[model samples]
Target: MDRPSVRRLPRGRHALPPERVARAQRDRLMTAMAEVMSEKGYVKTSVEDVLKRAVISRQSYYQHFTSKLDCFMAAFQRSTALLERQIVEAAAGAGGPVERFDRAVTCFLETLVSDPATARLCVTEVYAAGPEALEHRTAFQQRLGDHVADILEAGTEAGRFTCRLIVAATATMVSGPLLQGDHDALRSLGPRLVAHVRDLKAAGLL
Candidate 1:
């Protein structure tokens, strides 16, 4: 009798078992990449440095990512995800839209002050990392801006606030002082922020 022919799996339908190991290595590398970037900036960090920090071989690095920029993008996304969660959490459970909006701003500013290095990298490194990084950063900013706008729109619809400005303008107005290094003004203006929300609530704009 003729031997039966062996069957082969279709391409791309199943991943190699090694893919899981590769993913684990990639995650560790991304963590190390963020630490290096946060401490040294992208321009100053080398592939070898990342490899050393991650304790992975050069072959393993390339197996998981195409280039340093790829890893940096992953790290950038991770950092932004954490920031977004914090902002959302800070805004959570507020009495009204305006209060929630103010809390979001406060959370963002506090994040900046607390993690200045990471903040600096997020704000300053995009341009230096070239177009791809810039695009990623821009996307993140736009998403955050959209969220801010949503909050403002909610406030407006609820009669908790009155503003003719667009969402972009409203978001900028809400966050401008904090981003522009006017923390003292923000601190002094804290009561005003709260009052603004209160007034909105009282006016039924919230």
Candidate 2:
């Protein structure tokens, strides 16, 4: 008997494993969600719109997300995580806590200005995403605040800054406005935002 020849996949084309396919679908859905939400507010963006944009089947969308809200949250969370990483990286090389804080704030403002869609998704749609989404947003904001508090604590220890910091409150005060501001607004507010941190040091507010 002659041995059968296996059919090889064409160049740049092959069946992906289940995990890869799933991951790809999730990413596509999230990307489409972001674009659609940016164009239409979260409340108006339908799952059908996202599916059409992503070119994914309803069954595939359901496999990854339970609802449009779930998909929006997923996109928001991922974008926030990326923003966090960008801030961390930008601040990493600064000379000290104050400088690090300044660098981080600048990067954040620049990012928001440069990527209005992401800023809108994070600061605007997040509020309108309903109760659970608000909860997630609040939690992430608190986490960001904690990070700022750590920087303030380090600065205080070094005698570069003073005051006891209510980390979450301070973080919200700093980030809330910047995140919600438009491109031109954030660009103009950059200096003020930095000054706000400096004032925190001056006032011994940490």
Candidate 3:
């Protein structure tokens, strides 16, 4: 008689464990931190505020993160990752380099528009968090800049767009505006922004 074969589990499907529970709790706290920070600003948002919103104990919170800033950084990083994934996937499916660039621009704007509070936190409160948060923000910008450069370089090489300026500098310009809290204003800026990126000299992009 032969031994029975074990069935394979699907991707991302596995038995729950203590680590998973801990992660879930941490995610809840981060989400709550975003909401509370948006409402009260980072300086005013206490650990108790997050605890109340997350429905977790103070001990549970400390178990996952060292402090409020730590939790905020985790939330910022997670949100940034999600935005990057959406933009990349959208750009990848487009027909050509220019189209990919346009799709990425749209996705980037929409991500901020869909969540004004998160946008506000990133723009205004993140710097106020502390030195560590500022360092994280700089690193985040560097990573995003590299991604933007890859897209622009592809388009430039394909002769679909002109990129005379430094790629990193241009990417930083593209990212700076999306941090605004006013969705209505940002929506209006999208068309002009795209046009400016394409025709950089026309808009004094340098």
How high a TM-score does candidate 2 get? 0.78
lDDT of 2: 0.69
If ranked by TM-score, best first, what sequence of candidates would result?
2, 3, 1
Better of 2 and 3 by TM-score: 2
Per-residue lDDT of 93-191 in model 3, one digit per residue for the tens? 646445566777677667667775566555557878988888877676656655655665533432322332333343445344545355666565556
User: Which residue pairs collide, candidate 1?
Assistant: 159-204, 159-205, 159-206, 160-204, 160-205, 160-206, 161-205
Off by over 4 Å in 2: 1-13, 154-182
- The alpha-carbon lDDT assigned to residue 6 of candidate 3 equals 19
TM-score of 1: 0.64
* Number of the top-ranking candidate, with TM-score as the measure: 2
TM-score on alpha carbons, each prediction: 0.64, 0.78, 0.75
Better of 1 and 2 by TM-score: 2
Show pairs that collide, candidate 2: none
Please give the CA lDDT of all the candidate structures.
0.64, 0.69, 0.66
- Mind giving the per-residue lDDT tens digits that candidate 2 earns over 59-136? 989999999988988888888888877877777764766777777777777776666566677777887889998898
**103-190: candidate 1 lDDT, tens digit per residue:** 8767765666565445555665555789998888767776776565566554444332233233234334435453455666545554
Off by over 4 Å in 3: 1-16, 154-181, 201-206
